[model samples]
Target: MRAKDVTGIIGEEIAAEYLSRQGHEILERRWRGARGELDLITRDGAQLVAVEVKTRRGSGYGHPFEAITGPKLARLHRLLLEYCAAVHRLHERRRVDVVAVVLSGTSEAHAAEHLIRGVEHLKDVS
Candidate 1:
């Protein structure tokens, strides 16, 4: 796999671990539909959450969370609805969350030093 893809996989893994620690039950990973993909789908109590994972090597372009644009958010919302309908899961409350994972540096040493240097969880993001 490409380095970018590997980075994303690592990011998702880290995000999943973080969410699990936060008491969120992971329902799915890399949930795909006609619209697009949701990195993680989780159940937090009675609320169903659709999570988007953004991974970055550094801040050369921007923060990992900055990659989530208005259109991208809209697509994620649509995907969530589609996923709900397909699974026949009725959720009284639903939300969109973002898991931003930033690595320490671009060098291999940095990558080996810390898989994820920082992680930010933004809940109920629109």
Candidate 2:
């Protein structure tokens, strides 16, 4: 796979582990619906969470969370609704979340080191 694709996969995996350590039960990863895909689906107590993950090697463009614009969030909300219907959980409490994964190192050559600069989780984003 391309470096970008690999970065995303690694980020999602890291995000999942981080969330799990934080007491969130992961229900799904890379869930695709008619609308689009949700990076992660997790349960935080009684509420269902739909996570959108953004990963980057550096913040030259901007913080990873900045990538999630208003339109992207709207699409995520629609995807969340579709997911609820698919799983027959329309009545359950739900919320949107964002997981920003920033990796250390300036180039792909250092990917072998596999260092994480940070992982930020934003809950109830929508």
Q: Which candidate has the top score in TM-score?
A: 2
Residue-by-residue lDDT tens digits, candidate 1, 18-118: 99999999999999898788999999988889999998888886988788899999988888899998898755578999999998777643344555679
Identify the candidate with maximal lDDT.
2
Candidate 2 residue-wise lDDT, 85-123, digit = tens: 999999999999999999986676545567899999998
Off by over 4 Å in 2: 109-112
Candidate 1 error regions (>4 Å): 108-113
How good is model 1 by TM-score?
0.91
Model 1 vs truth, CA RMSD: 1.9
Per-model clash counts, in order, read 0, 0
Q: How far is candidate 2 from the true structure (C-alpha RMSD, Å)?
A: 1.2
